[model samples]
Target: MEKREWKVCVTGGGSFIGSYLVNKLLQKGYIVHATLRSLKDAKTGILRGFPEAKEKLVLFEADLYSPHQFEAAIQGCDFVFHVATPLNHEPGSSQYKNTVEAALAGSKTIFMSCLRSGTVKRLIYTASVLSSSPLKEDGTAFKDFVDETCWTPLNDSLSYVYHDDHHKDYTYSKTLTEKEMLSYNNNENGCGGLEVVTIPCGLIGGDTIQSFASGSIAVCLSLITGNSETYKSLKFLESLLGKVPLVHIDDVCEAHIFCMENSSMKGRFLCASSYVSIAEIAGYYIQHYPEFNVKQEYVEGKKVDVKWGSTKLCEKGFVYKYDTKKILDDTIECARRIGYL
Candidate 1:
């Protein structure tokens, strides 16, 4: 089938990775059905500005909590990209529970929709590195490297023990969602012959077409904009997490497209470039943009070793287009252009 004749659905098409993926799809002449939580979201305006968006892109309103809402958006699509997952950073608010519920329900809803669609041949799920096995479990760090075979240990007891840590909750949600998705796929009657491929990505950073920065990019922007409160919160969290594996936004978008086109691609693929600590990122900003008054402080703590392997992705003939340095540079440039710097 011609690329223009192929209809694909992208959930959370206005998000950091989603926006980039939507633009790429439009450029390739694919008919894209993109979903947004609301028409009022600023991201809707940003996505509408993409090239050929008016001609090839269709916007639909869908809610993560409401699975039935996705039916209209995903029906009659050739491929489904389930990229929208909720991230709750607010520990004090009840948003964490809502976020977790949304992630799980939303995934199941999308998967079931794909099964019902009949036209969807493949479903590309954008998972997180957190969904994979932990670098540290039960207060003891694992000595081995994390690969596709590793699954994050879901300990309800441990989850309650670390209830104060919001990251743990988020991680649990992703792990459960991924596990359920895979389990559903394995059930011949459940997936209806629809192929599911999960891409567990690391700390996604780099230029985004969205009006606002989110995820790791938001953390970077906090430092760039000299937001002390935000910086302190992120610094504390990063200190506990250690040097996270970094993945360029563009590289991640490319991985989505590559997975869609490559029929042989199956299972989980790690989409990350390299590892860099939060302190190292601060140091880079301080050195490059001294006027920003970027603070650099080494948090004295046992850094969790993030030695996750991405050799499987590389072996699949996928090459990273951006390194750590390039990622930082591109991010700063984009932030400046967008007046966030």
Candidate 2:
């Protein structure tokens, strides 16, 4: 289909990454329909980033579990970016069941609706690094990188302990949800059989383009604002310092656009800038905001062990302009540019 005629719909348009995606699509001159849970919410300053987008961006109140709602949302859309997912982390959180069921059901619903409607030519699903790796094993992430194929396949004994009470449910949901998405063995062009592209992304970092941040921006801000209880203190510091892969939010958006533009790309794409150690991140922070106590102990002048990998995307010509140094530099630069510094 022609770029100008492409009518795109992004689920979770008010969200962090989704907002960016919507804005980018609109900037490229494509008609966009964005989904919100309610018209009231959308009218109440939900889509403030692109006020002009109100004309091109249609707000549809849709529920993930309700197949009918999704069917209505994707009507007449040429591409679907299924980016919405439940993110609650409470241990007894009943939201997990709803979240998982909704994601699985919502994907099927969107894909099926797209195929049946015969409108969408491609569909991109917003997946996560955790979906690929559960982190169920109690090992320090002491490595440098993690790739698309490297998923955390913990046995029954491991899923319970790999994560904490806060995020255990969330991690498990992502792992199972990704698996469920992959399990669909539909042939191309089947009803709901448009190309399914999975983006396994690492920790997203960026400032809020809007007053309200969603997805990785929220997570990064939480870490920055010390709201993330999981990555605080010495133990958390050591654990985090062990290993992680990092990506700037803008790059991730660009990747989504890139994949959409390049129709031949299929299967799993591990979106990351580079493998970064938490200690290295801490060092970067120390260079500027020294007051943030990213507590760590120096034993023999060495840091702890942590590991992640990213090779598949690299092989696919997704060049990372930012390494650890570049990431920190760009982050600080972005902060300065946006006056966060």
- Candidate whose TM-score is highest: 1
Residue-level lDDT tens digits of model 2 in 1-341 = 68778888888887778777888888888788888766677432646547567667777787564546867778888788888776642245454354555566667677778777788767777787765542325642423435565566545454333346435555556667666565543564443546777787777775446554334443443335555453433223234334456787777887887777775656778787766555556656666666655444311225534455556666766666556565555555555565554
TM-score of each: 0.87, 0.80
* Total backbone clashes of candidate 1, pairs 3 or more residues apart or in separate chains: 0
lDDT of 1 by residue, 80-198 (tens): 99988877533354533556777887788788888888899888999887666543556355535667876666665543222345666677778888877777657856666688889
Name the regions of candidate 1 deviating beyond 4 angstroms: 88-97, 156-165, 188-190, 221-242, 299-306
Q: In angstroms, give how far residue 145 of model 1 lies from its true place.
A: 1.2
Minimal lDDT window, size 10, model 1: 156-165
What lDDT score belongs to each candidate, Candidate 1 first?
0.76, 0.63
Q: Give the C-alpha lDDT of model 1.
A: 0.76
